[model samples]
Target: MLGEFDVGGQQALLDAHALVIGLGGLGSPVALYLAAAGVGELTLVDHDTVDLTNLQRQIVHDHASLDRPKVESAAARINALNPDTRVTTITGRLEGSELDEAVAAADVVLDGTDNFASRYAINAAGIAAKTPLVSGAAIRLEGQVTVIDPRREDAPCYRCLYGDAGDEALNCAENGVAAPLVGIVGSVQAMEAMKIIADVGETLAGYVLYLDAKRMEWRKLKLNRDPDWPPRGGGGGPGAGLGGAGRGWIELDKYNRVKKPKHPWV
Candidate 1:
């Protein structure tokens, strides 16, 4: 099997290192496909556990894994599928110095997390590390995907399309999400990650692909390179998206207080 990938010119993918955040709907498919595609090293980050409801969309976690940490469960599945692919599990949020280190080590970072804070953190880290970050988001029937290569002079980042944490919308927990919707986005994320690592295919660096499952339509949202933004920088404090504004904190806290028992996706 290893020989098959090596001889087929897929050796680059097999030797590639990727970091995947969140082990839910999007992360599940991204992780599974990347591992099966023979990525050499994969790091799965998620602090949440497998709730019974997650089984609907988080296909990586089975009924038996209910109540187990999502990252651990997802890593076990990846190991079962492809032992040649090394899996590392980080059982917490990616923040502070820890976030910087993870991004620095990854050849490509895949964003499957559902929250704005985590997404922004990964975006800044991608810029700091100058690694390509493939990001995707899905809720209800809508999905979007983008690849950000900070090293590319023409690439647009996650913040360029949407502001930082300011006025960020609710995630799947509050609004609910469809199962297959994330699958579509995750598959695209996996594709972009592969292209970024193999240095082939036209990557989605400056554009966002939006999918509407109900209508079965695909929209490509183009983003221009913002020269005004930092061409080289670290952290989301000053010139970051939304200018370091985080108005979502208050509503997020309130929502957590009410839905803490019902939903545990964080």
Candidate 2:
């Protein structure tokens, strides 16, 4: 076993609560490992259900779970893996007060949902709660992972990276993806979330870990802080995380609503 984490870290994991949004490919590995690692409680959220096509990478569900809500399928898997880990399931998207309440209750939040809409809303919720967020995405042969910690002023939030990229975030359904790609990214996400729960190691905050499966290589790219976001001071309070109007796009309209993701995300 790695010595970087000890009994105290193990205990920290046992006491930690992790909220995982999306019960699909990325969420599959994240939920399984978090439970296996002994995270005390987990809140699983997904508006979709399992389908025959999902078994490729959505390893949490099998044929028997098809037609079942993703959260329920994943919770069952998590319970089977670690009976002591308490699991809660939410059948739909978390928005407004519901979103904030969920993020506030968790020690860390994991974003495995596809689409910029869900990502942006989750980002805002994480920032508002000052919670650590571990986000992962995979499509085709590529994947990306990052940490946005509102607790750290210098760390960049989700909007900082994709604000100018517009509201478009691609998904596996629209674009073909290799089955194993999500597994790699999801595993890294699980590791990062566990590290946060255990209070060990430096997280990917301010850096995006990109993987190219075709080339089997990884690049850690630094994320620059947006000068206008979180509105410098009393304008939106310190670290409001989504306030500034620098990009010509309206933040209020964007954060206030989450469009349905192009694909069913886990």
* The best candidate in terms of TM-score: 2
Cα deviation at 244, candidate 1, in Å, is: 22
lDDT of 1 by residue, 155-245 (tens): 6676565543343366687788889888889999998888777766588887767787889998775665444467443224222222233
* Alpha carbon deviation, residue 129, candidate 2 (Å): 0.5
Q: lDDT of candidate 1 vs native?
A: 0.75
**Best model number under lDDT:** 2
Output the worst ten-in-a-row residue range by lDDT, candidate 1: 255-264
True-structure RMSD, every candidate: 5.9, 5.4
Kindly list the per-residue Cα lDDT of model 2 for residues 63-113, writing each as its tens digit: 999999999989888888999999999998788899889999999999988
Q: Rate the local accuracy (lDDT) of all candidates.
A: 0.75, 0.79
Candidate 2 lDDT at 207 equals: 77
CA displacement after TM-score superposition, residue 96 of candidate 2 (Å): 0.4
**Candidate 2 worst ten-residue window by lDDT:** 232-241
Mark the regions of model 1 whose C-alpha exceeds 4 Å error after superposition: 1-8, 231-266
Q: After superposition, how far is residue 90 of candidate 1 from its true place, in Å?
A: 0.9
